[model samples]
Target: MNDHDYYRAFLHAVWHDRSADPLVASLLAQPAFAVYRNTIFKGCVDALAANYPAVQRLVGAQWFQGAALAYARRNMPQDASLIAYGDGFAAFLSGLEEASELPYLAGVAALDRCWTEAHLAADDAALDAAALHAALAAGQDVRLVPHAAARWRWEPAHPAYSIWSANREAVETPDELAWRAEGALLTRPVGEVRWQGIGPGACRFLDACGDGAGVAASAALALEAEPGLDVAAMLGALLQAGAFTSFH
Candidate 1:
């Protein structure tokens, strides 16, 4: 095999194999192989832990580490890069019978996935209120585009965010009774990712934008989806969240 092909194979074996393959053993001694193996495993564990902090909190550190190791062994990421690892983790959690008792766990995983997506998505200019007002004054039918990095989803649990926030230090089970499926928006504004729970109207509006609807059409859809929804308030919140890019 060519050098490139040989290196690729070595990487595959190092990442996926619990036992060192002959190809890897020939290149590095057994001690070197063991060290490299530990490094690769620890790297995967660290990445998973960083991405799924809330999950780690839900499951204690020891259990979380065990689960993460199992997941990494079973689903070694195809790409050497860890930019978007664990994309299928939510589904994986859903399929695991052990995690079946925590129904909200999968939802939390989904939220984390969205946060990852928002973090890596392409950057865009935020729509300013002054610009929007100017466009309105010009009688132009301008349509705001939601930021490419922005994402919104509903979780069937109240205080899910609170639970996630608390998980950083203490382990507290959220009150499922008081929790309703809460909708959240994730966006990067000024280079920092922010999560905000939005009202039904704002949620519908953002969804409409994602579906390629114009501003007026999205507003109408929001109104249809939620009666007594303040369109202005929704627009202002979107603006504040830096959720929109330029208008067409």
Candidate 2:
């Protein structure tokens, strides 16, 4: 094989298999090879920890580092940009036997990943709430468009939103609310990623908006999903949160 092919194979083995390829086995004896391997692996681990802070916080540093390294060994970054790494980490964690006890841990990691993505997403000008209201009053048929950076849908299988929020404050979650299913909405309305827990109705409404539905149609969908939901209040809350980038 050519030098480039050999090197690529070697790196794949070191990063994904956590071992030296037979072709590069001789180099493994060199201290520098070990150092290089450790450095690359550690970089992946650190990136994961940074991106999934809530997961790390829940599992504790040492445990998280171990888990991170394990995940790194199994999943190499698809892109060279470490910032975009760990897209499948939550799924990886969900499959781990070690994380079986904490089923919600994976969901928390997913939220943290969503937060990272929202933070790094491209900027967009949010539609002004007053202007949207004016358009509605004028009887214009406008559909609210979510910002490019918005993560308006994050409905985890487990009740992880509470755990993620609590991790931000380093506080213990109340037992009663710890495992209650929750949803989250993330948006970068003003250059800062902001997130909040959303109810089933609001989540449904946001989903409809994301699908390019108008305010009235989205509210109807929300009401269909949750009969007693206050559609007007939910729309107001979404508007106040700067969830829309423009009205179409």
Candidate 3:
């Protein structure tokens, strides 16, 4: 191996407590190596804590740190940028035995991940309602697409959206949150990310848009999914929220 490769191998062995390299086999047990290993693991834990602050806040720092440590040990970052780390952390939480008590924790963590994605998404001008109307009036077959910074999902089994929204920046939650499924829509309309809870129909409408449907078709699909849904209002809300961009 080259010098850089050997150096990385040495660090990996130290972190994993493996004698993978003959030259570094003896050094792995040394005190300095242990300190480096611990520091690296601590950094991983810290990144996870920052990435999933809602999870940490929900469970408290001590418990979150413990869980983070376990997650770090098994799932190291695949990229140099720690910001993109913890992609599967919500699934990891869902499988943990201790996490079973908090049925909505994994879903909350998933929304937290969505927020990060929307925040880091590329900048673009959102599609204005005027432009859409003009295109349709001109008889153009214009497909609508979600904005680059848009992220949304329909959690059909839990009130994940409500729980996540309430607990994202604050420790407080609703006094009596309805025990039902919810959906969420997140987008970077301006420079910062913004979010709002949506209904299943809205989620389906966004899905249809993502699947390359025209705005009218997407709204039709939404209404098909929910017969009583106010698709016009939903479309208006999404337009006002800067949820769509012209299809590329």
Candidate 4:
């Protein structure tokens, strides 16, 4: 094979199946290649641990690393940047037989993924409360959108948000949890990632807004989820959370 083709096969073997590539088949028995392969595995595990700190903390280092290694076997980083290594980790975890008992683990992994996405998003000016109010006062249907760094998730199956929000900073689990469906809102409004446990009303409202619905329509959706929801107060809270970008 040509040098380029040989190199590609070698790398493919390192990342995937050694026996599957002609070049890799030749190097598998070499001591140097073996060491290099182990190093790559360790690097993938390390990258996964960094990318999913919340998951690592919840599952502990040994268990987390074991799972990370397994995940890396099937899903290696497509990009050179290790920071973006674990994109499908949550979904991967969800399918793992080992993680079946821990129903919330995959959700927590998803929350961690959201935090990473928010942290890495391009900076954008969030719509101030005054600006939003002014556009509404003018009786105009302006296009409003979630901020570039805004990410939210709502899951009715498990209290994933509560557990993740609590364990995000440190490994301090709450003394007691209500154990119900929960939602989380993440934003990097001021160059620092922030998160909070949100409610069904806010979740539905954000969902509607993200679908390009207007203010009234979004409010109706929120009210449907929560009959006595204080729509104005929810807006103010979301405004404070930097959930919106500049209105057009």
Error of 3 at 61 (Å): 0.7
* Evaluation by lDDT, superior candidate among 1 and 4: 4
Q: Pick the candidate with the highest TM-score.
A: 4
lDDT (tens digit, per residue) of candidate 4 on 105-189: 9999999999999999999987877878988889876666999999999988999987887778885777787789999999998
Query: Which regions of candidate 2 fall more than 4 Å away from where they truly are?
Result: 1-4, 16-25, 154-157
Off by over 4 Å in 1: 18-32, 78-84, 137-139, 156-159, 168-177
Candidate 1, residue 61: how far the Cα is off, in Å: 0.9
Clashes of each: 2, 0, 0, 0
- For candidate 3, lDDT tens digit of each residue in 151-187? 9988888998887887786857888988998999998
Alpha-carbon lDDT, every model: 0.78, 0.82, 0.85, 0.88
Ranking of predictions according to TM-score: 4, 3, 2, 1
Tell me the spans in candidate 3 whose CA falls farther than 4 Å from its real position.
4-8, 138-141
Candidate 2 — worst ten consecutive residues by lDDT sum?
Answer: 13-22
TM-score of each: 0.82, 0.88, 0.93, 0.94
lDDT of 2 by residue, 1-248 (tens): 78998978787757654444666766766778778888998999999888988898899999999999888888887788899789999998989999999988888888888889899988888688888888889988689888787775555467788888889567987778855568888888788888898888888887888888887888888889779998778878877787878887
Q: Considering TM-score, which of the candidate structures 1 and 4 is the better prediction for this target?
A: 4
> What is the alpha-carbon lDDT of model 2 when measured against the actual structure?
0.82
